[model samples]
Target: MKSLTSLQHLSDQAILSILEQADGTEFPDFANRMAANVFLEPSTRTRCSFEMAEMNLGMRSLSIDEAGSSLQKGETLYDTVKTLEAIGVSAVIIRSKEKAFYNELQDVHIPIINAGDGSGDHPTQSLLDLLTIKQEFGSFRSLQIVISGDIRHSRIASANASVLKRLGAEVWFSGPQEWMPDGITPISADEGCRQADVWMSLRTQLERHDAMEPVFPNYLEQFGLTPERAERFKPHTILMHPGPVNRGVELHTSLVEAPFSRIFKQMANGVKVRQAVLAEVLKTKEEKRYEKAV
Candidate 1:
């Protein structure tokens, strides 16, 4: 069975195929199939999007969280997933605090969709982001995209940057100096806002930090998409944020629903992207099963 643990596992053709599938009106039926969402970490967007995708495809969804799962009783992630697989769940979508948590589940046969793994990679999020960008720009080549915010703690930053760059987009990182990673063109937030085709903001990720300072006092003025900074943006520049947005922090409250913002559009596209992913992955499993039966 195929699993989508990273974007590295997906070819350009495969990526385009999924996006194409998402835009189609008809979908395959998996009425009797079951999918499980096993989120060890807190989430709203990814989890809910997957659940909605599952329902849209006529699949039953089983939700498992830290509080309600065997994980609370010292069960390992592998054991928990194996249990679901043993029970014949069609696929398992997981979000974990541990980076590359899927490494531990290599032996499990079901299709594993990495919802988010610590700050490592979030393939599905990257796909939805691509869908959002593609819907707006209709292409990725030579597009100036600036990913600005808490880069160190952002899976969205890490996931999208590499893929965007490989797809021929000129990608840059702009945020707090402390959060900036090496090996990318780091620009000032002002420069990004002024020139970017897509200005994508990341959340502060306070829960991942050691300190409880939820909002840095000068984050908005310095690195965030404030109304004043946004005014400097090109007329065609589109704003993006991987939600749950911290109003007045990574983005000012006024810009959340501004004419140029694609924050909600990203969330809306997420369901279709995930629906494409689930359908494609599970279709392979069904094909193999048919082959074996024949």
Candidate 2:
């Protein structure tokens, strides 16, 4: 595939390939190819992981600042990508507040990896999350995973649910009623915690709701991961978040350092997963080029 805008773009085989490569111990080189990251939105994990992935692959990199880029001077998305391509970048990683922002670059020639797009999808995050889970369970078949918190505005949840379910995992949602997605069976946070092999909490996107007032007055008591709730988690249950976590909102501060918390593991796995993606996409492109030349 030329670009990965959503988990739907990945087949089961492709997903397995990325997970397998991420599990490897050896680092691969990509000669001296170049890639650019254009993040029009604020980020910490996604941006840094992609940069680290390129560096690990022996590629030169460029990180575009929203304020300094030509976008500040009225450059369109297409123009920005074309400029990167003109400068010899064969791949571009982009994150934007606009949903499916990469859709506008269909004819841009260069490979576009969607770091994030509004509340759309974060495919790389999903892949690394899968890697983290697979490392824990050694398989996805029938594993119970409960994603709790602001599901209504979560791109991670959207990408993960699709990919995890596709891989034979049983995915469920738990959060504020208003924040739950349609069609998914919603369970109480406490019940979800009890049954889940993987309990993934999400930050409440207070910025997305009109009633920016906390979802509930004592949200910690009602929904957040309190000490009592933490103790109730299944013996081997894993906890996670796609962070910038609100300490006392979706999860308790202590759980951040809990033994079962795989938050940092997920971050570390992100680099490996992204490396796999960059290698696969760029390698495929180069092979096609060689075939045409012959």
Q: Which candidate should be chosen as best, given lDDT against the real structure? A: 1
Candidate 2, superposed: residue stretches over 4 Å from native:
25-27, 183-185, 211-214
lDDT per residue as tens, model 2, 1-294: 777788797789988888998889466687679999899989999999999989999998988978988899888999999988998997999999889898789888878999988889999999999999999999999999999888988898888988899889998898777777776667987888788999998888766677653457787788778888888888999998988888887888898989999999999999999998898889778888899899
Candidate 1 stretches with Cα past 4 Å from truth are 183-185, 211-215
TM-scores of the candidates are 0.96, 0.96
lDDT against the true structure, each candidate: 0.89, 0.87
Global CA lDDT computed for model 1: 0.89
Q: What local lDDT score does residue 29 receive in model 2, on the 0 to 100 scale?
A: 80
Q: What is the lDDT of residue 156 in candidate 1?
A: 90
- Residue 69 C-alpha lDDT in model 2: 88
